[model samples]
Each structure stands twice: as structure tokens, then as C-alpha cells.
Target: MDAYKKAGVDINAGYKLVDDIKNLSNNKDLGSFGGLFPLSLGAYKNPVLVSGTDGVGTKLLIAIKANLHKTIGIDLVAMCVNDVLAQGAKPLFFLDYLGVGHLDNEKAKDILAGVVEGVSQAQAKLVGGETAEMPDMYTHGHYDLAGFAVGIADQAKLLSKANPREGDVLLGLASNGLHSNGFSLVRDILFKQNTYSLNDRLAGCNRDLKDELLRPTKIYVKSVLPLVEQGTVASIAHITGGGLPENVTRILPDNLSAVFDYGSWQVPAIMKDLQKIGHLSFDDLLHTFNLGLGMVLAVHSGDADEVQSQLQAAGEIVSRVGRLTSGDKQVIIRKDQQ
Candidate 1:
């Protein structure tokens, strides 16, 4: 027999994946090889293409530990889409890559279904993807997923860190608790505490720990794209592996830094539990976990309240977290002081 057959990777599963995704793969319209998007020049004076690619980090280990394979696909899509959105681009299409030790049809299907769900939520087309079953690696019952997303925006319409000025306000949209980042530290906490199962519910949290952990990364595309379309936001930051302090600064101009009043928003209960139980310090908690806020938008001070109102009406928990200041590169998190 073939090497794949000898190595436990079923060649039949590869055929089945393509066959099952025929409808999805055939939705291409423009010049993408595996996936396509129609060029609609209806709205742009001069359009520019923005693309981002990202993978769900070690968070896959948690999903594998909990035997929860489906929702991680959403994380894969969200990671890439959110990054592009930070550049004021609306996601038009998404593609994925799934790699594993061996092909498991049921698990692969579950993952793809979640990816489709994420694409639908982001209002983007699910184009195509690569699924590789590499035997003798990754150990059984484990896999990794990543995704790429492409978006279009007018060259002049795209946002830049230059928009952030001395008086711009920082508005934070609450996260759904540790969404697809900081899992390495989280796993460390669990291992250090000797807790093997993620399903064990925390002391005061409303949901099982595994359920909370598996909560799909939020797709802020639809919610924030309208604001970008209206030309209201100055800059946007997607909080990923690095917590607020680091991620927020990436989108700030060289002359501006963020001065965050960390007490402005309430920290979610799960983070509180992690801090108290795991004996994590304030610095670690702020630098490692989302602490409830996911995405932050920098806008003119005059528009801050209005933008917050609009985002709130759209069902996003918007908070006035801080302000842009004239300084060198650094993010300052402090309480109001005398």
C-alpha cells in the first residue's frame, strides 16, 4: 500500500473533504486561485486590498484537552479577520488551514462547520482551505488551525495611527473572556495548579471552565465596519496574544501613546478567579489576559461619546477607557491620581 495508508492517514478522507466543500469552493468570482471574490468597484475612488493571516495559538491544546474541536475554527477566522479590521478593512472572504497527525473526517467536518459559522457571522464568504493529515507528528487527538482573510478599502479611506492625536479618546469593547489569546499562560496556570480537566467549573463563574474557554473569538467585523464606513474612527486595535498595553500601542503613531485608566471598566469574573486562585499578580493579569476588553478604538475626543453610544446601540459594551497623549512609544495604565 501507499505510505499514507501505512502511516494511518486515510487518503479517502482527503477526497471526502474536497467533495464535501464543493459548494463552498465553487463560490469564487474574481482572481483567487482557490477562492474568489468579485471586484465591486461601485463604492471606491481608489480601492486597496488588505490581507491578514493568523493562527489560533496554543489554545488548540486546550480544545484538544477538552475534546472540543468545533469552535476553535471560529478562533482561527476571528484572529485573521480582526487584524485586517484594525486597518479599517471589512473582511470579504476567509480561507483556512488545518493540519493534524491523522485525518478524522468527523472532526474535520465539525471544524469546517464552525469556520462557516464564523464566516457567516463576519458577513464574509467561506472560500477554500487546506487540510493535511501528516502522520507521525502532532500525536493523535491533536490538530492545529489557522486562517487568512482578505478585505478591501479605499486607499484614502483606510485608517492609520496618524489619526490618533493628543485628545483622541480610547473606547474599549468588552471581550467574551480570554478569546483565543493568552492560552499559554492559562495552560501554565492549570498545569501549575494541577488541574487536568477544563470542564471543572470555577468557584464563582456562571459557566463551566471548559465552556467559557471554548467560547468562540468574537467577530467584530459587522459591528465595527459600519463605523469605519461612516468615517468616524481614527484607529483601531485588535487585542490578541498581547494584552491591552502592548496591542493597543501598535496602532498608535510615533508621537502618541495611550494613557489608560484601567479602573474605568469592570474586569470579568473569570479573570478575577484566575488572579485570586492562581495567585497571579496585577502585572501578569494585565499583560497576559484580556481582562474583559477585546477591541479598542481611538477617535477624536469630540466623537468619543457619540461613538460609544453608537457602539452600545449595536450591542457592544463600549467603555471610555483612556486617551491618546503626546509622548514617546509606551502605554501607560494607571488609576486617576492627584
Candidate 2:
């Protein structure tokens, strides 16, 4: 045996996995030092390259524990692509990084299959990625995933340049359960403190607890990009880590505040179950999980109905959640009225 293989880093295994990844993603250039992408500038006179990178977070722990490896890569791609999409960009290509202690070919292939599915969902190509097998760096069966997505947008149509004004209507797109955030708390509440197994089903949830927990994050590219091109969407927020309050407030101007009509959109049952069982406060829930809305858009009141119509026509569940108001920079969840 080679000294390196004896020491735990198997070069042949890494080489074989690379070939398998290339085959899985159907990209022959994946094993190259750098991923190649051809830029076609004909689409926009003033094109801007938008890039975003994110990881699957501790959600991977759950995936590993549940032995569900196929869809976690979707969460990885969604996390990065949606952020770029929030800026009104069209995803062009994606790259992923995997770090593992040992290179298990089947497990690696399963992960890559999900990445391919995610790239397909985003309408992006999997150009390149890295898989590092470092013995002792990770547990024998555990690996981590991170993804980077590059997109293109006309400079004139960037969502960040859209100035959100007071009275602008807030439109929310439905989420697919807890989409890759607040899983640390979820694991603690469900497995640590409560000792619930992955097979255990909580009240109001139809599937086993594993299914709910491992649901891939929703990708919002196809639904929102058309609105962005039409200039109907003023600003967009990808609700992730900090939930609605923090993510929405990022796109808001200093003089305006976002006031959401709480209950206007139905919060997912899984979120409510976590709150009830975990004894989590509404404020905590607001700051942690998405609570159903994955992406929020700020549009002019006149364009609100049309934008909602367009998003619905694109097969998204839309809601007129709330509107911007003249106030300090903050998010206000009003339960009194819709």
C-alpha cells in the first residue's frame, strides 16, 4: 500500500471519485483545475456578474443521522442560487465543495446526484467543484458541503438598486418547511432534549419527522426572474438565516419599515409544532425559522396585483403579506389585521 493510503488519504480513491463526479454531473471539465464558463454578453448591454456562496449548515448532521444524502445538495445549491436570484440575476453556473475524512464513492455519487438535480432546477450548469479527503479532519462517515453560484443580470435591472418606498406592498412566496436554517435548535429540541427518533412523527405533520426535516429548500429563480425583468419587483429578500425580520430589513431603506400582516399567510404546521413543543416564543420563531415565507418582494401598490398574478401564474403560492410604512428601519408583525 502507498504510504499516503496507509496514512488514510487515498489518492486513487480521490481520482476515481473525480471521474465519477464528472460522469454524475455530465460535465467533462469538472476534474480540471478551474471550471470554464463562456460569457455571452449579447443578452445585456450592461451586464453584472452576481455570485453567492452558502453551506448546508448543521442540517447536514440531520441528513447524515437520517441516512438521507440525496437531497442535501439541493439545499446547498438553493442557498446560493436564491441569494443571487434575489439580486435579479439569472444563474449561469454552480460549483460545490465537499470535505470528507474518507472518500466513500457511493455516498459521494449520491451527493453529486442531488447537486445535478439542484443545478437543473436552477437552470444552471455544474461547471466545477472540489472534493477533499482529509483523514482526521472529519468523522469517518461525515462530510460537509458548500456551494457557489454565479449569475448574470443587466445592471439596470438589479434588485438592489430598486428603492423600496413606503406603502409598497410586500408579497411573500411560500416556503418548503424549515429550509436549511435553525436546524441546530431543531436538533436540540427534537433529539437532545426530547429524545425523539427520526421515525417519530409530530402532530400536524403528515410525514415521518425525517421527511419534514430533510425537505429541500425551495428555489425561487424561475418565479421571480420574470418579474425582475419586467421591472415590477422593486426589491427582493431571500428569507434565510435571520428569518423574515433580518433578511427583509436588509433591502429596506432607512426611512421605511416592513409591517407584515401576521396570519395573512398560513405558517407551516412543522414550524408551529416546533414552537409548541419547544416552547419557543413568537419573537424567537420570527428570528429563527422562515415560518413559511421563503422569499419576500417589495413592489409598488399599483404593481402588487399584477406581480402577484404573475408569480401565481409561475406556479408559486403568493400572498399579499403586508406593506412598507413610514417608520424606523425594522420589521413589525401586526396580528390585528390582514
Candidate 3:
């Protein structure tokens, strides 16, 4: 054993892990200095590259605490690919970075498998990734994951804040659960403050607490990409850390605001449980968590019905949650009159 191995950095094990990744992802060029992707501008007259990067957030803690590593990688890919999808791009390739205190080949393989699944779900290729073994940087049996996704879209057809206009209807896609946000608060409330265990089943929830917390984020690429291509979508918002109010406002023009008809869609029971346990206010819930809707779209009023129909046909649970109105660039959640 050399001095470097003695210091906890195993060069040979890293090389073996590279082979493991190549087998898991089937990317032969993964061990190279940089990942390679063959880009073909099939239908894009003027192709524009859209890129996004994100991490799984403190949600990793839940996975680690439960010793569940399979689905976290999906969250990693969803966090990035969904962002690019929000910009009306088709995800082309993905890359991941995993940092760990010690290299455990089995655990690493499980995590990479989820990444592979995520890429498959997004219809993107996993070109390459890096696994860093840093002693003392992270605790043993714990790792951090970050992912980068690159997508392509026609320069003229790219969705932006300017794309949304007044009278456009806002369509919200239902989220499965927490979908990888507000975990810092979730952890504080469920574990630090309350006595809930991952094994305990909360009211209205079908699965155990661990299953709810670790539910992988839903990838919107497959369902929303078709709408983007059809040009029915004016703008899309991938609700994440800032929840609906913060994320929806990002794609709203300065003179337009999003008026959401709250209670239009079913709020996942897990979210309600957390709110009650934490005594969270509506505003707090709005600012921190996704609150059920994962991705919201601003569609032209004329095409709202057709778009909703198409989303339903694609097996997406969507709601006519809001509309764009003449106001400052903000989100207004109001009770539904009808």
C-alpha cells in the first residue's frame, strides 16, 4: 500500500469504479478527460444549447439516513434536466459528480444505477461523470451528488419570461410528493422537533414516511416536451426550492402576474401532514416547498383545453390552476370561486 492509499484515496479502486460506471451506463468513453456527445440538429433550423446544473439538496440526508441510495440519483438528474426542460429544450446529455469520504463500490454502483434510470427517463445520454474520494470531506457512508444537463432548442422557439403574456392560462402538473425540496425544514420538523419515524405512516399517506420522503422527483421532459414542440406552451416553470410563488414569477413578464386558483388541484397528503406538524403558514408553504404542483405552464387561452387534453392523454395529472393577468411580476394564490 502506497502513502496515498494509506491516506484513504485509493487509485486502484477509483479505476475499478470507472469500469463499473462504464458497465452500468454503457458509455465507453466515460473514463476519458471529457464526455463526448454526437450533436445532430435534426429539426432545429437554428439550434441553441440550453444548460442547467443542480444538486439533490438536503433530501440526500433522508436517503442516507434510511440507507436508501437507489433513487437519489434520479433526483439529481431530475433537478437538472427539469430545469432545461423548463426553458423549452430537449435534454441531450447528462453528467454527474459524486463526492464521498470513502469509496464503496456497491453503494456507488447503486447510486449510478439511479442516474442511469434518470437519464433513460429523460431520454438523455449519460456521457460521463466523476466520483471523488476525499478523506474527511464527507462522513463515511454519506455522499453528495450534483448533476449537469445540456439540452438543445430552436433559438426562435425557446421559452422565456417574455413569452408569457396577459390572459395566458396557467396549467400545473401534479407532483408525486415533496419532490426534493424543503427537506431542511422537513427534517427539522419531522426528526428534530417531532417524534415521527420513517416507519410511521402519516394519515392519508399510503406508504411509510421513508417512502414518501424518498419518492423520486417526477421528470417532466417526456410529458412537457411534446407540448413544447407543439408550441402550445408559452412558458414553463419547474417548481423547486422557491416553490410556486418564486419559480412561477421567474418566467412572468414584469407587467404580468400569475393568479393561481388554489384548491383547484389535490394537495398531496404528505405536504399537508408536514404543514400541520410544523404549523406552517400558507405563505411559508408557498415559499419553501412545491406544495404538490411540480411544473406549471403558461399556455395561450385558446389552446388551454387542447393542451390539457394532450397532457391527460400523456398520463399526466394536470390542472387549470391559474392564469396570467396584468400586474407586477408576482404570483397570487387565491381561492377558486368555481
The global Cα lDDT (0 to 1) of model 1 is: 0.84
Ranking by TM-score: 3, 2, 1
Clashing pairs in 2: none
lDDT accuracy of residue 234 in candidate 1: 94
lDDT of 1 by residue, 111-222 (tens): 8878887888889987778888887777958888889999999988899866778988999999988898888877877766666467688876788888988888898988
The clash number for model 1 is 0
Candidate 2: tens digits of C-alpha lDDT, residues 1-338? 58888898888888898888888878888888899999999879899999999998999999999988999999999999999999889999999999999988888888988999999999999999888988899994889999999999998888873478889999999999999999999998998879899999999999999999999999998888888888888999999999999999899888899999999998999999999999999998999989899999999999999999999999999999999999888899998874
Q: Candidate 3, residues 1-338: lDDT per residue as tens digits? A: 69999999998998998998898888889899999988897798999999999999999999988989999999999999999999999999999999999998888888999999999999999999999999998984778999999999999899978788899999999997999999999999999999888999999899999998999999989989998998999999999998998899899888999998888988899888888999999888889989899999999999999999999998899999989999998788896553
Q: Please give the ranking of all candidate structures by lDDT, highest first, separated by commas.
A: 3, 2, 1
> How accurate locally, in lDDT, is each candidate?
0.84, 0.92, 0.92
Which one wins by lDDT: 2 or 3? 3
List candidate 1 stretches off by more than 4 Å.
1-3, 23-33, 336-338
Better-scoring candidate (TM-score), 1 or 3: 3
- TM-score of each candidate? 0.93, 0.97, 0.98
Name the regions of candidate 2 deviating beyond 4 angstroms: none
